[model samples]
Target: MKATLIQQIEDICNTRGVRLTPQRKRVYELICNSPKASSAYELLDSLRETEPSAKPPTIYRALDFLMEQGFIHRVESTNSYVSCNSCHDKKHFSHLLICDQCGSVIELQDSDLIALLAEHAKQHNFAIHNHVIESHGTCPSCKK
Candidate 1:
């Protein structure tokens, strides 16, 4: 699954005529392999295992590149990153359902919700380049 997703991302980057540098790919792999959202420092630390000179800026730059390409999602409330399941194209919309107890994240795509938000934005004369809705609640396993 991880390999497949990475290949898909590589293809997307190629289609966009952007270079997914080795460091960026590593950072992306870290985030993709993680079960939960990962903070910048955590990613840096992990990256340091292989790249002893890896710095915070290194992770940030890689993350910035990935985010710009819309291959990853940033959890706003917690300030972490996650690559949710299903990666066929550059993710344009992110509606996340977060588990407050287990720290799990589920990314959802709802066209109706997107339209709703767009309508609200239009009413207020707001031009949204991109948006994410982070809704926190307990998961079924956590509820148990």
Candidate 2:
């Protein structure tokens, strides 16, 4: 939980005129602090440890807001979510490297690749919305 990131997200919310409610804040904090991507049920269970009244809708709403704000990315393959540290910087397409053994995620951005893909999509008449490239392998620690 870096104070800078929290401040940046707070600033983004303030600038966007969106309220970062306590529930949303807590859920995101959990996601950001996690060593690996987490499932919604895991988040809900962890959140419930403190907020006994927390429910599925609460987690869903937080996830929605987080995604909309681009502060987090959903790992499509494993049905999990990871915090995007650079998302507060800008909006761009990125590929993810997932550690199959540890479930840790690393995000990689390639503007040239994104441009090429966009061009290819245009050629194929495919309108891209959400894009996530998940490549799974062992991470450095897991390679041991």
Candidate 3:
């Protein structure tokens, strides 16, 4: 999974004319290998193992680039980041379902839900640009 994700990131960067610097690639790899969303500080600490000089700014810069290139997603509620599963696909809005027990996140793209939200916004004369919905609950694994 990590290898495939890295290859996809490389392909997407090449297609989008985005530069995947060594630091950015490493940061992305760290996120991909993570079992759940990771905080910037967590990334910095891990990076420092190999890159002793790595600082918060270094990690943040790489994260900014990765987010801009659609290689990752930020969970606003948790203030952490996750590797985007839809990086190689067309841009679309997605909500996150977080497992409170395990901190796992499932990205969901529901057309009906999106459309309903859009319609609701339109009723109030608001133009929808982007949105992030986060719902927390126990996952199936944790429920068992």
Candidate 4:
């Protein structure tokens, strides 16, 4: 799955005419290979294992590019990031179900919910731009 995801990201970058630098690719790989969200420091630590000269700015820059390309998402609540599984699909509003017990994150997309939110925003004459919804709870596995 990790290899496939890397391939998918490479394809996306190629199709979008985006440059996938080695640093950016490594950052993306670290995020995708992780079982849960990873912090900037975690990514930097991993990068340093190979590239000792890596700095916080290096990781941040890579992360910024990955986010801009929609390859990964930042979990604002946790100040961490997760690889986007729907990157190959059309862009849409997504909500994150965060497992407080296990630190797992599940991404969900509901057109109906998005529509409802849009309607509510419209009622207040607010133009929707970007949003992040994160819910924290115990995951099914953690419940057991």
Top lDDT: which candidate number?
Answer: 4
Q: If ranked by lDDT, best first, what sequence of candidates would result? A: 4, 2, 3, 1
lDDT of each: 0.88, 0.90, 0.89, 0.91
Clashing residue pairs for model 3: none
Q: In candidate 3, what are the lDDT values of residues 13-113, reduced to their tens digit?
A: 89888789989999999998888889999999999999999989999999999888877889998999998878876466888999888888999878899
Q: How many clashing pairs per prediction, in order?
A: 0, 0, 0, 0
Highest TM-score: give the candidate number. Answer: 4
Model 4: which ten-residue window has the lowest total lDDT?
84-93
Off by over 4 Å in 3: none
Q: After superposition, how far is residue 130 of candidate 4 from its true place, in Å?
A: 0.3
Decoy 2 TM-score against native: 0.93
- Candidate 1: lDDT of 108? 88
Pitting candidate 2 against candidate 3, the one with the higher lDDT is 2
Candidate 2 lDDT: 0.90
lDDT of 4 at 70: 84
